[model samples]
Target: MLEQTGLKVSSRYIAQIKKKCGLDVGENFNLPKSKNARQPQCTPEKKEA
Candidate 1:
């Protein structure tokens, strides 16, 4: 959109603007909500230990 307006604003500047306007800038809602979503795979030996 900035390209269309011929404006050369940095990503940091855009994030600041979005924050000031109270807009959802970088939030990702599609991620899993489960607590084990990012748990690493446990080996049988590690589990037994």
Candidate 2:
């Protein structure tokens, strides 16, 4: 909307301004963590009988 009025600003700069105003800024990274990965990354290709 501001751009329509001839005002140009970058997203980074907008975040900086919002932060200065004590407002929530930046993207939400609330990713759900996976269950415990107790299994080892490497495993035997074939289990010896």
Candidate 3:
């Protein structure tokens, strides 16, 4: 439908929309790159002795 209406979904267009909507402009802005990407204190839970 988007292609038929000429309102397509492209990387450039998406980036522009994101910018207009005050969203992140950089790639992987909201996504995690790794398991401990944002976790500075990652640790495993301890079991009872």
Estimate the TM-score of every prediction: 0.41, 0.42, 0.36
Lowest-sum lDDT 10-residue window in model 1: 40-49
- Candidate 3 TM-score to native: 0.36
Error of 2 at 3 (Å): 3.7
Query: What are the runs in model 3 whose C-alpha is more than 4 Å off?
Result: 1-8, 27-49
**Span of ten consecutive residues with least summed lDDT in model 2:** 40-49
Clash pairs detected, candidate 1: none
Candidate 3 residue lDDT tens string, 3-48: 5554434565556556756988886556676876652321122111
Each model's Cα RMSD? 17.3, 20.3, 18.4
lDDT of 2 by residue, 1-49 (tens): 2555444445545555566569998683753477663422211221110
Model 1, 1-49: lDDT tens per residue?
3556545555545655667568888965576788677633433342232
Model 2 TM-score is 0.42
Which residue runs does candidate 1 get wrong by more than 4 Å? 27-49
Sort the candidates on TM-score, descending order.
Answer: 2, 1, 3
Better of 1 and 3 by TM-score: 1
TM-score winner, 1 or 2: 2
Query: Which segments of candidate 2 are over 4 A away from where they belong?
Result: 1-4, 27-49
Candidates' C-alpha lDDT: 0.55, 0.47, 0.49
